[model samples]
Target: MKITVQLFARARDLAGAEHVELDVPAPGRVADLKRSLASRFPQVSPLVPSLLVAVGTDYANDQTQLSPDVAVACFPPVSGG
Candidate 1:
């Protein structure tokens, strides 16, 4: 499955791009995406655990299933004073 991922804040900085296209297996899961991102973008490895993943407009968990046409958004954990 090929999915387009939108990177936000720290994720965007780590990836050096606002968006990235990833080619995953036909039946892919959020866990797969996490691993792939870490391997492909080493700078993002540390942040993967804390990333907030959204499949479309809804938040998704690690086991969430993914499709080729779906778009995923990754946001680093946010903190406000």
Candidate 2:
């Protein structure tokens, strides 16, 4: 399955790109994709625990199931007042 992952804020800076295309296996969850990303980009691995994921426009849990057709985003916590 191929998914487009968008990175934001500090995650984007660390990853050195705003988005990336990932080829994940069938039946993979968000967490699995995260792990794969960390392996591929070791520089960003340390920040994984502080990251949040979104499926389409909604926040997603680490265990959330993913489909190839869905749009996903990975980012650090957003802050505002």
Candidate 3:
């Protein structure tokens, strides 16, 4: 299955793009997708451990299943007052 992934804040900067398309196996989970992303974009691998993932706008866990039609977003920690 293919899914559209959005990179936010520092994640976008590290990846050098706002969005990317990923091709994953059916029944893939968030963790699996993360690994794939790291492999595809080695430059950003160092940040993967601190990244947060979301599916269709909701925060998701590593085990969370991915839906083909859902939009995924990778978010890095934010700082604010």
Best by TM-score: 1
Query: 17-44, model 1: which lDDT tens digit per residue?
Result: 9999887776999989988888889999
- For model 1, the local distance difference test gives 0.89
lDDT of each: 0.89, 0.87, 0.88
Instruction: List clashing residue pairs in candidate 3.
Output: none
Scored by lDDT, model 3 comes in at 0.88
Q: Which ten residues in a row have the lowest lDDT in candidate 1?
A: 19-28
TM-score of each: 0.92, 0.91, 0.91
**Which candidate gets the maximum lDDT versus the true structure?**
1
Relative to the true structure, candidate 1 reaches a TM of 0.92
What's the CA RMSD for each of the models?
A: 1.3, 1.0, 1.1
Residue pair clashes in candidate 2: none
lDDT of 2 by residue, 1-81 (tens): 888899998888888999888777879899988987787678889989988999989999988999988999998888979
